[model samples]
Target: MMAAIATLLATTTALLFGAIGSRGGKEPTRNPEELVTVPAAPSKPIRTSTVRSQPSAPIPLANLPTSREPTSPQLALIPKPNAERESLLERRKQAGDTGILPGVGIPGGIPGAISEPSAANALVSSLGAGVRKAAAGQPDKAYALEQKDTLMAQGTSIRCALQTRIITDHPGFASCVVTEPVYSFTGKHLLLPKGTKVMGQYDAEPDSGRIGVIWERAITPNGVNIDMESPGVDNLGSAGHPGHYSAHWGSRISAALWISIFSDAFKYAGAKYGPTQTSTSSGIVTQDPFESNTAETIQNIAKQAVRRAANRPATVTINQGTIVSIFVAKDVDFSQTIKAH
Candidate 1:
């Protein structure tokens, strides 16, 4: 019982303190001086460094190197020749020499200098003159041919006039001369001047009684003798007739035989039919007698026909002043070598 009473008394005392602490009250004020604020002290001024500049100065020429030559390998300058060696150069210079030095291996050496002509130069000039004279003295090819002193290639044709008259019935052979000038194919060069000669032979044809000719050789104006074959009649142009004849001698013989038989038959018929009458010499009777004997005439005609039937020789004839052409039969060379003067 005593413990309970003591607990009650403690509880009562705590309750009373709690109630007092819980009650509300007005807030209290502080001093105004304590609330006021003060500004900070001012900072010290800042400091900086300053710098100054000066103008540049010029360099002097006396301090530079004097030489302009490079350090690399190059041609060295040749020293002036000694007085003894320079005598030749001085002599050349005195002669108005303006070009490279002769016989010396230098070009454009000195101006206002003259040089004497050497013996070699004079010799060369003489040789040149001689060569020119020789060339001028050479004969002109065209002129030589025009004068007939030179002949062109063979087989060349030329128009020539006959100087001699030829008869078809001439015996064996005759020489004919060409009197007119004959030109070449182009008529620009002469083939034969005047007086070129040719020889020919003629033969007769028994059947046709025709004549033919054959040329053997010719002589040139320059005295060159050339052999030639017999030329064709057509190649002679209008100068001669073609050498040909028919071989029909039997036809002539047969015709002559028939004429003789008819004549005999006519005579026999005239003798059978006659008129009888008294013969009187009242008027001079003029009887026309045939001078030719019938048998004799027939016999002569037969003989002539027989002769014509045999082969006759061939021949050709040309009249005077007739123009003819002849061609060369072989190659001819006229070129000759010329030597140095």
Candidate 2:
């Protein structure tokens, strides 16, 4: 009985302690620093920056290597020869050296630099001047062609005017310059600038006054060589460069003079008539056929040679600044050679 009472009292004491421990599960107040957190010190705002870079220096032209000459295998520094020539041509054109500018007398022409001689402009003025209108007409936009690319198509015309030139019956070379800038197919870029140089050659003893020209090659303003085997044409698209044929008067006269001298000397070679008893029949005696025949044969040969000398072809005279068109026979690609502005 005493043992049971002691066990009950012990169980009661354990239950009382478990109830108090379950209700006080939080940590004791002495550790208050664990519940508090210190706010981080505020940081200053970040600053951004924009840095600009300097450009590289340009290269000097003197430091560059020499360019290969188009005509020869040698190297040279022929800078802007086309431009210089064009400027000189412009000066000449202004001074009326060619008697007309490239775009003269047309409706939408580059206006004549100077007043044309009334004689030169007579026909052009007469056409418009005779048509008089009283009321002012409304202005309209000018017509323009659309250029697309740098390819100069075949059959395209590159108009050029040659300087005063004369060609003899001997093989020689000649050249011409483009009169204006040739736009590309799309009209967006330049194909050949004004003053483009074109080189070609003529054969000895041209068969006719209408000399057939095979435009050999072309050089652009920037000195880029373009391959060309284009045939020449007139403004009306007819073939060849036409010139006036002048006979060699000096050679013909010389041949005639030789003929006169030889004729007198050869006619009396057989014999001479002299005073005789029977002057009628025996006065002029016939010489041996062999000697007479030999003289006659020699005289015929001399005449033949003179005739041949006089019949040789004379020189063809092409007036200075005669214009021609290069009928391009193939597509001219300048994309790799030139850079667009």
lDDT of 1 by residue, 1-341 (tens): 89999999989989987777766443557766656678999999787666666766776557767776554543222223574357556656633423334444325433222344466655665676687687779765653333233344455654455566655544566455666665544455555567878776655433233334456776876775656654424354533333334444556557657766755655554445433233436665444323334545665665665566443343344567665565554543332210110
Q: What's the lDDT for all of these models?
A: 0.53, 0.70
Candidate 2 runs further than 4 Å off: 1-148, 247-254, 265-301
lDDT of 2 at 43: 100
Question: lDDT tens string, model 2, 200-283?
Answer: 776656666777778899888887788999998878888877788767787777776776566546556543432223323557
* Residue 296, model 2, lDDT: 69
- For model 2 the local lDDT of residue 310 reads 72
The clash numbers for all candidates, in the given order, read 16, 7
Name the candidate that leads on TM-score: 2
